[model samples]
Target chain A: MEEESQIPKGRYAADISSINEAHARIKSLILKTPVLSSTSLNAISGRQLYFKCESFQKGGAFKFRGACNAVFSLNDEDASKGVITHSSGNHAAALALAAKLRGIPAYIVIPKNAPTCKIENVKRYGGQVIWSEANMRSREETANKVWQETGAIFIHPYNDGRILSGQGTISLELLEQAPQLDTLVVPISGGGLISGVALAAKSINPAIRILAAEPKGADDAAQFKAAGRIITLPETNTIADGLRAFLGDFTWPVVRDLVDDIITVEDSEIVKAMQLCYEILKIVVEPSGAIGLAAVLSESFQKNPAWKDCKHIGIVVSGGNVDMAVLWDSLNK
Target chain B: MEEESQIPKGRYAADISSINEAHARIKSLILKTPVLSSTSLNAISGRQLYFKCESFQKGGAFKFRGACNAVFSLNDEDASKGVITHSSGNHAAALALAAKLRGIPAYIVIPKNAPTCKIENVKRYGGQVIWSEANMRSREETANKVWQETGAIFIHPYNDGRILSGQGTISLELLEQAPQLDTLVVPISGGGLISGVALAAKSINPAIRILAAEPKGADDAAQFKAAGRIITLPETNTIADGLRAFLGDFTWPVVRDLVDDIITVEDSEIVKAMQLCYEILKIVVEPSGAIGLAAVLSESFQKNPAWKDCKHIGIVVSGGNVDMAVLWDSLNK
Candidate 1:
């Protein structure tokens, strides 16, 4: 049961207690997002689905919970120097806003080729933009240079104990909100979210089932789980811009050992799920956010005998930072 | 203080007690929709706004409240025959669902020109659809014919006392959810929603202010308020299809004596609010539902001396039954 030995020394520190501590630490700093359901959706899926609407969380995503916890966990000396991160996604904006609340500067290393809206989001939150080339190597180099120059703490988006523990708080809230939940469907990217979720949920209710949803175009997590090792892809293709990252050392072991299964879905299925969220649930969800719903409604999940008795399902709706113009254009095509 | 006498005898009968009874009668049948708020929206509007999200109600609108109340209030003899209504909007679908739940028939007289989606909604709810000309006269005649054929009781969308009383339940829930609310901004259509809101809110707290929002394209409510009488427009226009109807005898007295003011907004403003709801609030609201937010953010309300101190406000988001294909087409154009 003790998986701590599997992780490298002085790394992968989060556990159920740490997650509970994270909840206590950041309780006042984040919004307790609502759990929503639709009767019509229930009929279609042949199960009662409770949607944990993290889309309504501050910064328009659940990223704020982790970022806020990570920023606040710093020592006085580290806090005085502010924080730094490399992300062209929700984490960049979340970290910026979190730092702003704590009255500290945030250095955000975003690729130059990143969308204008994302760049604007970081700037709107008072984050100092540090442009890098359009690749992970350039982004890390730029962030490292900023950390060297400013002595600012480097906050990993999801591959850190502090970050994942904060993300784990969602599981505690989810279980409390719907105690009858027998299964949790979460979208897998870098595995920070599901790592935290699996730890917290399994610790709380040992009988609970954890399923990971992955984009078929970027099924690195599914491959890693099957191969019993991490598999980093040189190229990834998917409309889910948020779910392209490979699992880190901190997240891989938890995902590999704890996840019940990984379900990969096509881009078209994600689009259909997004439309359903918009039309039936009356809630907007980015492609990545819609993955959990897509997984729940997928043919594999519906027909699989293992998941036949999983009647009460909880879906983590992770984010809603979509570009409407781009989404509608793609949808029209 | 009694306004019941203003209505013709044997016509309007709902009061605060009747509204309370309606709440008890239909409480088990409908969802208690959430009251949502946004910090950025509050900062932009310079007031704390609580959105009473009736869009999450049954049948995707607050019409279910009134329809359910009316359907359930019938005696065994009257209820066995079923119910009838003439609507091509949220009310039609709401009535159909309400009747279906009671194990009775629902005869929905819809205009021939009604959108395919709306027609589909009624049919999906097991309503028997009767087609008539697009005009109200023909629709009414068709509904009358259906009523005579089946001996079914007629359920008006909003004009009836029972319907308004059922709608008043929103005020009770909203006030309890946000006790600090000093003003209620409601979208005015046939005046049922606002009239019920005003009566209940004022009864609960005499100092509470009630403001009605009307689309300038179909600004009959504003005109009637200014002229001190009902002013029916021969040809009404507005993208907010739900707000085109005039106030009825049962609702006029409530609006005339209880409502503080009626604010008319441009279709452009309503569209902007709809976009804001989609982008910022992550909620889909029809044009009529968005009008309350539009009115609150309007320059007239922002600059008005009378409402300057009205800080804690509640906006009724009336519905979310939108045709996204049509909406996207118009937006693209």
Candidate 2:
């Protein structure tokens, strides 16, 4: 870990140098996920769309990149206590797998209503799951209790400087993979992914533009951006269960100032994008993962003349931890 | 086209040299599909598995490789007449896309019962679809009539030397991607893919083993191998719609002499493999595409003591052109 004096002074913990450090630190630990493109999709979107397939990342999401970096960044003495996180999604599985690889224990506080597939992933990665009520307060409280009892380090899913720095490594590889990309359209939830990606991409090429895609049902990012302040939603509802969370403090500043736009898409549009991903791209992407494509294909983005310069666009497919049983049920109906 | 005298004298038209030529010819036209590996899958199979993701290939299948090669291999005069093929599968769409790219018309003879998704694919790629009775005899007759009327050259899906040679390019890339692979488990339909892969892989590494994976309902290849002769099934029924066709004369000799073994898997096993592909690899693979993985995970392969030396294995995920509507209907039931 870097000394406290050396830590970058910013609204967020991560800076370009720290992200670069995270990239170097986790280079061998994570997969250099491929950037895929479809000619048909490109033709339809009228833009050269490149997909950074984080769906193929370890633990089936880009979360592994951040989790691995955070786990490895810990000092030998600090790491002995293991790690803890409150997540019912990709982050839980990612941290578990990362800790397992580092030969450290991971205590995961998962909601009782969490998908079975996610629970299976955590168990498969040797995570000790502590069940919690399907509410943020209960989940966080349980995580706090576990942290105090086990002396385990609390690893925030997206609100940590180290975690965001690790996630930023995606742009390091993405730009190297396709440097011609003038714009990056990323799905935003807790804003960690977009924050990291924007910081790294802008640091490398200040001319590059970043657009945050959000589901209309959970359009807190768009609301926050419009209001110029954090706007917490009373409730959230969207098929993209992963994107229901609002922006965290560590992620908000980066998303607010650095990210150029927040494009909200309807659930129907997201479903269409998911279908296109299945039929054309031949990749299984959860609803949240498909939002970037949905945002680009949405009428607002296509009709907006201000963003016509985005010829070469990079869309980050954030994750692929979809519950097929639930998806089939919904599709069947 | 190569002179008749220059063509190799063998049961099949393609040889190591022709396959090499095909690779060179299609190098710029086709995609260099990626080889992906899952650590969890490798752990489960107890072997280092490298997946040649031809699902990511153009036309969502490996057929594009051969189709592109065959279209480009034509002389200017012959190419002027355009190309024709009798099929309602990946070949029709692949040929259509290849022809479109080559600035030629593709006349595709499709059975009326063909899936709507396939028909849409042909139309999307500008292939002129000539509907035929849902039988081989009627389809072939219709194709012959169209050939005579339009003066178009017939491009066999897998039986032709050029098509097989084009398919052989997969092994060239696969071997280059993973040279340590001691064995290749390839899904067999008309034996075109495995024949081409076998010829190319064995030519490069004489000791490399080739295993042909077949659906149990369409186990003509397995029966033929056991009988030491061609054994055509009067009727074939398989969830793997692509693997229902038996071996062609052009592909039979190669399968008989070059392929080391044929492993037949049940539909249930293939479905399980497909689920694993969606849930774990996050890739959409049709039943035929998942057969290679199913063969690897089958009881026969797992329990067999004779094949213990196989460590590094390459599984060719053949295609990803599934009809989601039909899939959902079946899964719902």
Top DockQ: which candidate number? 2
Off by over 4 Å in 2: A1-11, A326-333, B1-11, B326-333
Task: Please give the TM-score for the first chain of candidate 1.
Answer: 0.94
Question: Candidate 2 chain B: minimum summed lDDT over ten consecutive residues — where?
Answer: B1-10
Task: List iRMS for all predictions.
Answer: 6.2, 5.5
| Pairs of residues at least 3 apart in sequence or in different chains that clash in candidate 2 | none
The lDDT, on a scale of 0 to 1, for candidate 2 is 0.90
For model 1, residues B296-318, the per-residue Cα lDDT tens digits are: 99999999999999999999999
TM-score of 1: 0.94
lDDT of 1: 0.88
Q: What is the per-residue lDDT of model 2 for residues B1-333, given as tens digits with 9 covering 90 to 100? A: 232232334746687788899988889988999998998899889889999999999998999999998999999999999999989799999999999999999999999988777788899999999999999999999999999999999999999999999999999999999999999999998988998998888878878889999998999999999999986567988888889888988899889988989999998888889888999999999889999999999989988885688999999999998888744443234
Clashes of 2: 0
Candidate 1 ranges beyond 4 A from true positions: A1-12, A113-117, A326-333, B1-12, B326-333
* DockQ of candidate 1, scored on C-alphas against the true complex (2 decimals): 0.43
